[model samples]
Target: MKKFIMCFVGAMLVLSLAACTPTPVKQSESATEPMVEASTGGASDKVPDPNVEPMEIISVYSSNEDATGLNQAMDAVDELTAQSLVDKLIEYGVLEEGTEVLEFDTKDGIGTLDLSKVPSSGTSGELLMLTAIGNTFTENFELDKLKLLVDGKNYSSGHIEHGDNDYLEYNRDYKKL
Candidate 1:
């Protein structure tokens, strides 16, 4: 009876060990092939692929929240990676909706942004806009300063004053009024 019990225990242990073992899966050669056909067309045909992963969303300062002057009002804008930061700010009502980026260029550590329209607002509003725009550009680009222009002319609002060609230091800090 002892011999039979010992043999039964040994068999049970072997079976348990076997049950816990993992099985290897064999993959076919076709499984490693490309899933989609490569495009052979020109550069214009290279539109954004829907199957590709989407870009990350980001937050920016909003003028509406700047009025309170207690906490920074950072508004989340979606699907704005393709759009310019200024456009996103405008869409968020930080600037006038009619404001358009005519041309933007960065060279020799200096960045220039030419706009077709400029928002007319109070000094505090202008300051908030400038801070938001300056921060956005400096944070993204490698630049020592930024020059903002509207229709090839200098930009001056109630409180802010700068020449059409003057380079303004990139400042991200904002003070509440």
Candidate 2:
């Protein structure tokens, strides 16, 4: 009688535990078919494309001292856009010809530019480069701040100093082209 009671209690406990546990949801194969069809598009309906191209306007700075004004253009923006903009500055004599952006990343609303490949110019030159970069990124990403890393170390723009991990806010008023 004791064995029977213990067995009954154990069974009840197991059943109660099982009842409290959530069951795995089983979806029918047909239910998933609609989602797949929607992604691929159906004969009658048009599905919105997810791979739409990104349109970005870049602010390109000229090297000429007299040309403080920026030139703007609608271009396909990417990580390399930072490098291209810097290269344009160098070509025009705004930045040193060898200056380049090695890598770029935007995470958690903070944009970082790796300038390991770029050599150090003077404070005035660095300030100009920084302004051009800040303006370009802010305009495109709507970001109010950015970080510059030179050779894996935090780079000070000389105009606005930022801590090692701090993001520098865009403070320059760039003239539109």
Candidate 3:
């Protein structure tokens, strides 16, 4: 009876261990068999309607929840133009409402964004705003640097100011705090 009990316990332990082991999934080897494709995250991989205009996926940057650093979110825009991007930023609340992109032009590797109004946020605010805007535009426009203008004039805030030739470089060095 003692030996029988020990054997029964050992067999139960071995069966439990075998249940924990994972089996490898083998793909169908037959060429004529239809293979199931893995999901590409979500519906983003689905085919678009032929009647609808194609849209572009763009990264829209906004201040994080703490309003300290930037966080990126993907957005779809009808066009990749500067106005469209600015509209997206406004929609995300990174830029203030009523902000308009007066002009956007790229020369060489530097791009200029002229806005109707730039928020007058103080030092840290300006920093976050500029970083979010610069990172977004530089990344989307494939620009090395970006210059900002307000009402066709160089942007100047209470805590931050830009010279006649000042430009913001694509700041990808800092991680989100």
**Which of the numbered candidates is closest to the native, going by highest lDDT?**
3
**Which candidate order results from sorting by lDDT in descending order?**
3, 1, 2
In model 3, the clashing pairs are none
Q: For candidate 1, write residues 1-177 as lDDT tens digits.
A: 999999999999999999999989655677767466567798877788888765645545555453733123444444443145777777767667777788888888888888888777777667667766666665556568888888866777667779655666656444453
Per-prediction TM-score to the true structure, in the order listed = 0.57, 0.48, 0.72
- In model 2, how large is the Cα lDDT of residue 122? 63
**Model 2 / residue 31 / CA error / Å:** 71
Residue-level lDDT for 158 in candidate 3:
79
Query: CA lDDT of 66 in candidate 3?
Result: 81
Q: What is the alpha-carbon lDDT of model 3 when measured against the actual structure?
A: 0.86
Candidate 2 wrong stretches, greater than 4 Å:
1-57, 62-64, 67-80, 119-122, 156-162, 175-177
Error of 1 at 108 (Å): 2.0
Displacement of residue 26 (Cα, Å) in model 1 is 26
For candidate 2, lDDT tens digit of each residue in 22-102? 989667876645434335456557755789765444655433344554444444445436676666556655556677678
Error of 3 at 9 (Å): 43
Residue runs of model 1 more than 4 Å from their true location after superposition: 1-50, 56-59, 64-83, 175-177
TM-score of decoy 2: 0.48
**Whole-model Cα lDDT of every candidate shown, in order:** 0.67, 0.63, 0.86
On the 0 to 100 scale, the lDDT of residue 90 in model 3 is: 91
**Model with the higher lDDT, candidate 2 or 3:** 3
